[model samples]
Every structure is written in C-alpha cells, then in structure tokens.
Target: MTDDKSKRDFRDRNRVAGDEEYEVGYFASKFGLSIPQVRELIARHGNDREALEREAKALGVR
Candidate 1:
C-alpha cells in the first residue's frame, strides 16, 4: 500500500530516530544547527514529522 499524505507529512516534519536516510551533518546543515545539537533535539524530543514541517515554516528551514 502507498503511504498516505498524512504519513508523508509526518515524516517530513519528524526528526525521528532509526531514520538512517539522513546523516548527522545533513540534519545540522538543514536546521542550521550543530550536528550534536540536532542529535540532542531529535534524541530528546524525538520527532513528529508533520511538526517539523510546521516548524520549518515558522523557522524557515527551507
């Protein structure tokens, strides 16, 4: 089955663990933060996927 838009939305917003698609450096650069900082945020807060996109809209990650 195909992933729904909601799932895609969630993944885009999330910075979830177990996601090996992204390297630490990649996340850092995109978020404009240090690698450790990105790691810490993801570790502590985990990810919502959709929330991240919203956050990006607010913070302008794109």
Candidate 2:
C-alpha cells in the first residue's frame, strides 16, 4: 500500500501532456525536474512521452 504522499506523487509524476503543448515549468514540476533539465529533455527527445521517459530513465531520473 502506498502512503498519501506517495500516491499524490505518483499521480503528479504520471501527468500526460494530453492535448496541451508542453511547457517547461509544467513538465519540470510534474517530473520533479528543473526548467533547464526539462528544456534539455525536450531538446534531446522531443515532446513524446515515451521518448522522454526513456531518456529520463537512462539519465537515472525517477
């Protein structure tokens, strides 16, 4: 079982871009990353969720 904080954090981290355009601040907060890191992720991997996840994993992020 997950604690409330863990559950909330999971929900927050799992946020999908959906129909909205990716914003650096939004993604950064959602993924627990910095603005510059988010920009670098998007720059290196584009805005695709899968690609971003893969790259983030490779970089040892959540």
Candidate 3:
C-alpha cells in the first residue's frame, strides 16, 4: 500500500497548500490577515506552517 502518512499529515496539519483556497483562508483567518496577504506570505516564504506563523506575527498580524 502507498504510504498515506505524508499526504494525510500535510492535509491535516503542518504545511499549507498554496493552491488550496481553503487552506489559505484558514491561515488568513488564524492570522487575522487578508487572503491576499496570506497568499503573498506563502509565495515569499513557502507553505511551512511554523514559518508562516512566525512571519505573520512579524508582520504584526498576530
């Protein structure tokens, strides 16, 4: 059987999929940022959850 852990872990928690609007919206809401801002952060910083959270806080979003 294929290893589903990678896919499941990613979708459930950890990295945010940049192409997924729902994930973006979730992060945006969590950070109190606009969707576009979250998208921009993802573009610039990639989709690592901890990194994004740190960056968001740095951006004064938290």
Maximum-TM-score candidate: 3
Pick by TM-score: 1 or 3, better one: 3
Clashes in each model (backbone N, CA, C under 3 Å)?
4, 0, 0
TM-scores, each model vs. reference? 0.43, 0.49, 0.75
Can you write out model 2's per-residue Cα lDDT over 1-62, one digit (the tens) per residue? 22355344444444434334455566667667776776787776676766776776666644
Model 2, TM vs. native = 0.49
Return whichever of 2 and 3 wins on lDDT.
3
| Local accuracy of candidate 1 as per-residue lDDT tens digits, 1-62 | 33354553454444444244355566657767665665655665466545543453455443
How well does model 3 score by local distance difference test?
Answer: 0.83
Compute the lDDT of residue 27 as modeled in candidate 3: 88
Runs with alpha carbons beyond 4 Å of true place in candidate 2: 1-22, 57-62
Q: What order do candidates take by TM-score, descending?
A: 3, 2, 1
Off by over 4 Å in 3: 1-12
Lowest-lDDT window of 10 residues in candidate 1? Answer: 12-21
